[model samples]
Target: MRVLVLTKPFGALPPGELAEQLAQAGADGADLLVRDGQTVTPDTSWRIAETAKALRGNGLELRQVSTDLISADSESERVIGHCAEAGVSQVRVGFYRYDAELDYAAGLDRARRGLASLAELAARHGVRLVLALHHGTLHPSAAHASLLLDGREDVLVHPDPGNQAKEGGEHWRLTLDVLGGLDRVGCVGVKNAVWEPDGAPGSWNCRWQPLADGGVVPWATILPGLQELGYTGPFSLHVHYPADDPLAAVRRDLGYLRGLRSGPFQSEPFQSEPFRSEPGTAPPAR
Candidate 1:
């Protein structure tokens, strides 16, 4: 598995600095975030290629991107086109939240239409869009996300076990089963969240923590299952937690992840990726 750091909290760092910090933490690459304040936002999308070059200079790859790309409009196309230019393969699409004013079916349809349109645009640009399971969105769980993904192989899903530990906890095996049996899963989200009681009566909330911290998600078990199922993809470790030294925390969690990854498939050669090559890039040497 390619261990990647989800570059959210370190968005304040420029691409070169972020890539160097992640490389120092022993991360394989960046799950590059494309947001308003980040290095590679919609307004600064032109930096994608240069950012990718900086990562490669540090022996890292820009394999995936996280973005708020929900429509097939010019803005979405613009970001994706630059991603293709930079050789990034996967783009995390935006969330579709549930609302009391909106019907669930209608909401689901809206999500699918947006995803389908986005997938078409991504395909045109040689990129694949992925959706992540969050705690409160329509994709709170892998099974629910599968409902949106049914009959659609053009898009993929990434299951965040930490988010599920907060609300939609299920067996890891069950999650892989629900997410189209691993074939349709593009990657996994690496983070941990634990519940803490509020001062008020019957009030509790979940907060983020590093993987080695006090969280209930058993990556020890899940990583093995993923390898057994022949799922080889990025584990996008999140660094959005409030930490005094987030890079140190990342180093610790990355060590934990590397230790858990010593399962059956760890030593095997990387399998050929089915994802089409980016435009203007040469194919991988066979």
Candidate 2:
């Protein structure tokens, strides 16, 4: 897996400056942010080309572009077209927030229809649309995410473990088990967090940590699992916390990931049980 900077942690900057910043952070690829207050937006399609050129000029590649929730089919098509034109491979689409007051079934139906239309457009443009596991959304776990995109290959899941650690967190082991078999998983978002006990007796507060420091995402386990599943996708580093020096923080986290990738972890055998009996060990007709 290769490292890709998400670009949101560096605030809004020109494409050239953004590329330079990522390069300084030891990143060779960028997952450009296409959101409000960023270099590109839904209305600004030309910026995609401009950003791609700047990244290439700086010896960097455009790994992916993240966009907000798609409420319209036309907008989704336009975004996919622009991304494909810019030579970007994947586009991370936003999610539909779950509201208890509204009709859940009707809302899901509408979401499915909109995504189906968007998926068709994405396929026509030869671009993959990513739906990440986010909190308070219709698709929060790998299993649920798989259900939403059902039979679409163009629309894939971008699993974010830290986001799953929010309010209703799922077991990471189960996440790996389900996502490993799914062909629709294109990328994985690297994020981690720890919940601190606070407020009431049973209450807790979340604190986002740098990649390897967090207690939430067991990188030691998940990294090997991903490798075992033959996942050769970009691991976009998402620093969701405030830092005195963002570049330094990212550099440290990047080093951690590199160590894991290049270390003996990948070569070690994966065992699911606590005790391992010797191979071919049989208690003589017991």
Candidate 3:
């Protein structure tokens, strides 16, 4: 599977430098989350285009342009147009506002309409739209997000395992069940979050730690399950850890994920009808 690292984690570096750093960290590509300083909107499309181009020049393709601003048809169209100009293949839509409140069902309705509109535009432009299951939103869980898809073949889901862990292992497992039967899941976000130490109450510190750090979500289990579910997509690493050397942490995690193996029982059998001989007939006359 391909691995795409988030470009925001290297926000301190210039776009060119960030691309190089991501390459060194073993990312096959990068997910561009465009944030314009104090605001989150599609207004920075030009900057996003420049960044996408830089990454492409450095041999790292922009797998998806993730944004929290595609809740309306106009916004979605604008973003898609910009992505097309930048030569991006997909767009990841986040369906929530910044204050962390569910933007009413009316907003979700608008988002559904927007997604459909965006999907059509994307197809016309040769791009795809993927909805990511973000934490603390209307579609916070995989099941909830699946309900939104409503059998639309064009849309895809980007599952973030670490966010599911925050919701609880039970929720995470439920998410897997919801997504287990799908055929269009395009990508997975591999992020690690560690529970705070003893003194910290009701708080969790999130960071991009190595797969072995025990702080990030358990990838060994999740990876095999994902493979079993036929989601052979990129494992994008999102590093939110605060450290002096984030690249080192990403490298270690990449190594750990690369070393993971699918065990004997990790995969499930493919479902199909049993083969049968001709009804009421003897063996074939050879």
Candidate 4:
């Protein structure tokens, strides 16, 4: 699988500087998550064009533009145009909160509409939309995401293994089961969180840790499983620990990932597929 780093880790840096640092960090590319006034918004042609130029100048390609900005239908179109201009082929859209107490059917309908809108925008820009499953939301689990995307061929699912820790170990397997049959899963986010033991804390504090640190999610099991499941998409690295150098943390995580396959624990290939797709299946037409 190819390795990618998200640009948000270096949010303090200017876009151009961040792009340069990512390339220097051995990243194949980066996923750019955009936000405005505390809310994530869709892309705009101007923003995408400028960002693309910045990334290209740094010798890095814009692999995906994450839709973190909340915008109206009219604004989404403009954002899609920018994505196309910026050369982004994939887009990740956030799902509604699954943890909320709302009418299940109504929530599903709302989600379906949002997906439809985002999918149309992505299509217009020749990009694929991946529905990212996040915690404290309506579709936190892979099963829930799968169900949410059922019958929608245009939308993809991104299962965050680290976040699934909130549901415990059993749910990890359940996540794989739910996402197994999807035909358009374009990427995976690898991260682990350390949960404080039992009731000894004021709050259930969690911290992002490198892959080998024995964080809640089992990377050894999940990473290979992802490979076996035909997930040849980008393995995006994320380091969200506070009070730590984000880039250094990400580099350590990357090192750990590389070691897993190189050390004595060397095992079979992560995925059995000879390539990302079948011989006859062409990549989605732009």
Q: Give a tens-digit lDDT track for model 4, residues 1-286.
A: 6777766667646566776677676677777776552112343246666666777887777787776532337777777677777778887776476535678888787777777777777786788887776776666777777677767778777777776665553344466666775355677777788877457757676656666576877677667665656667787777666525766766777778766544443244434354466888876654
- Candidate 1 per-residue lDDT, tens place, 26-120, comes to 99988888998887889888888888899999999888999988879989989999999889999999888878688999999998888889999
lDDT of 2 by residue, 1-286 (tens): 6789887777768888887878888887888888777778778866899899998888889989988846446667677888999999998887777888999888777778777877777778988788889888888888777677666666778888878988667765567677655465667888788888887999898888888574776776677667866878888888878887878888888888777765555333345445555888754452
> Highest lDDT: which candidate?
1
- Given candidate 3, what's the lDDT at residue 178? 80
Q: In terms of TM-score, which candidate is stronger, 2 or 4?
A: 2
- Candidate 1 — which pairs collide? none
Going through the candidates in the order shown, the clash numbers are 0, 0, 2, 15
Error of 4 at 47 (Å): 3.3
Least well predicted 10-residue stretch by lDDT in candidate 2:
266-275
Question: What is the per-residue lDDT of model 3 for residues 1-286, given as tens digits with 9 covering 90 to 100?
Answer: 7888766656546667777887888778888876655112467566667777677788888888877656446766677788888888778876743233545666667656766766777888788888877766656677777666666778788878776566553334456568654455777787777655545777565444545575646666667776666666776777676657868877877777766643433443334455567888675464
Best by TM-score: 1
Which has the higher lDDT value, candidate number 2 or candidate number 4?
Answer: 2
TM-score of each: 0.88, 0.86, 0.76, 0.80
Ranking by lDDT: 1, 2, 3, 4
Better of 2 and 3 by TM-score: 2
lDDT of 3 at 113: 73
Question: Model-by-model lDDT, in order?
Answer: 0.83, 0.79, 0.69, 0.68
